[model samples]
Target chain A: MTDETMLEEDGHSGGVVKKFLYVNRRAPYGSIYALESLEVVLIGAAFEQDVSLLFLDDGVFQLKKGQDTAMTDMKNFSPTYRALEMYDVEKLYADRESIEQRGLTEDDLIVPVEVLSRDEIKDLMAQQDVVLSF
Target chain B: MKFSVLVNEGPYQHEASDSAYHFTKAALEKGHEIFRVFFYHDGVNNGTRLATPPQDDRNITQRWSALAEQHNLDLVVCVAAAQRRGIIDADEMKRHGKDANNIAPGFRISGLGQLIEAGIQADRLITFGD
Candidate 1:
């Protein structure tokens, strides 16, 4: 093997871990920021980072069932959101207060998400290495 | 500590913008150095010089200008987003053959790379958006 290849192999003698937390707080399809933030989070997950998604307030609507973007002619990325689990980002959370306020049941969501209390959500935020809220 | 902020919500329209302003103020008070503040999407409107709210309420454009002037803050508006919203700088207006430039002082039009670089260079990247 070439010296460069050998160096490349030995460079990762120890695994490096990256942690990222993305906070979404808007209804899907209303604005581009919500969708763009999701894409960025997925990109982080693809890099083997520890990624967690928190859906707060109106952001919970992003997880709602039966979204139609056909009229807007916008790509329905809500389905792709379910694919986040395959990227090893399974720590999806929905705020209980938000769920209650929005009248959303667990059945109304697309993916399985852990519902968190307000205090629990605060604690979760404190645990993240990087927090990006949109 | 170095910090970067992404303010993607327009002031007066949402509390997110005010929250970001307060957050940055607190960070500065705490001795943290803000590397940049990137306005994207609707946030580009925050950099428009022509915005005139009622005298009773806060003028966000003026506030941002003051903040930028005071701290020498790197206030950036996304060029593409700015143009769509009628917020053009002098150069942009000339380039696009426009009659006017409405971008406020102390803010410059930039690209997504600045946002990425701001995040990479900072110890923390906080976003305030709706």
Candidate 2:
């Protein structure tokens, strides 16, 4: 479900909803942080909180398409990104500068995410009630 | 003021757990209400009762349990993260058909909703991690 639908269903009508931003700043597979952060996001969705996912630095690689963990012997959980929508977590943002520095484009990602400039991303972060980074 | 603390790293291996513990202590001492302390990722390891550190060092798990007992603080370990890292309570042990449980005192295994709930209920949410 989308955030709009969630707002309508809850009849928010100006009710205060805490905005939580899960900041992903690490690469996937190299450590358990990325995968675990996603787990928290999935669980947080049940509370109907205003949730947004931010991908910055090496974290952007977590959403890259065609991840193969066969050689690394790690379970490839990248596909879970597509399921975020089912949990009403529709606000996905990626840092434009980070992507450009890595020589990647939005086309390289597996999900549809808004690529925001550094200043815009900072503004977004400032608006959140809570920011959890991993 | 109300505060929520998030521990993102385990004990011994990282200072995140210790930092969170001290921070919680100071907050409570200053008359702040701790809504919850949500342990995630490696942080879930802090809830395990099986850790046996050197005699000269501090027992992190015991310290947390004691602090919680004194203040009635909510210490929650993420169930999914705990299950993955072999941290289980009596109920989970029975349900999963495991031999024994290793969750320490003053801590409970719960879902991720608790973390979000902490954020919503508290005036400030502080995270300590690597």
Candidate 3:
């Protein structure tokens, strides 16, 4: 379908704002995927799209507090998670199983996030127009 | 059908790029319209023209360029991801005061908005990654 027709069919011919869900499955610092995904989320917030972030697997560690990269020579960007609220991108979901597996509680994170079960997260993922994983 | 593809891995190192390429080609062969291909993370490396693979093997960058040229596809490399990985276009090179640029043909540098836009505009947004 053409772009115009797709927008028109959605009844938002003026502009279609899609639901974008970013799935974070990697740990921070080990690779650049986690940090780069955040960059996309931050930039995507500017578009005024319906955006949600999901933390699964080792991605739960990204929200953990007191992340020190002093010896790694990489800038610790964990503080940026707090600023997500200012961007109006507040829907942060952390998998309960992942947290429990890693022996972490909600109190350990730098910012507050909704802890959901795998099934609940699956339902949320189904509702998204786009699911981008990193 | 309209399709939007996302590639998250670099060339040679992973099969994500190759898989995305084949999927896109197959979709096009079946008369599907490609809304855009957003290269994120190491996938941005696919947009560099400096890759010099051996002559015997498939040149992934050239394959993408050729497909884009044949189909007039929109290949977008995320600016934020590209900058961190040293993949810059002429404008970004000037803005960042870099010595040169290596962005491949048929690929443009843009923000994450293009990706969101693609998801909105396309009927399907398929991602190939680890």
TM-score of 3: 0.91
Candidate with best DockQ: 2
**Docking category of candidate 1:** incorrect
Off by over 4 Å in 1: A1-18, A29-33, A39-50, A70-77, A80-91, A95-123, B12-31, B52-59, B66-70, B79-84, B89-101, B111-120, B123-130
Model 2 bad stretches (over 4 Å): A1-16
Ranking by TM-score: 2, 3, 1
| Model 1, span B1-130: residue lDDT tens | 9999998888787987788888888888888899999887788889988988999998888888888898898999866567667888898888879999988989998655455456556778888874
The per-residue C-alpha lDDT of model 2 at residue A22 equals: 92
**What is the lDDT of every predicted structure here?**
0.78, 0.88, 0.87
Q: What are the clashing pairs of model 2?
A: none
Candidate 2 docking class: acceptable
True lDDT of residue B111, candidate 3 = 69
iRMS of candidate 3, one decimal?
9.3
Per-structure clash totals for the candidates = 0, 0, 0
Q: Tens digits of per-residue lDDT for model 3 on B1-130?
A: 9999999899999999999999999999999999999998889999999999999999999999999999999999987778778998998888878999999999998767677778878999998886
For model 2, state the Cα shift of residue B32 in Å.
Answer: 0.5
Chain B TM-score for all candidates, comma-separated = 0.96, 0.98, 0.98
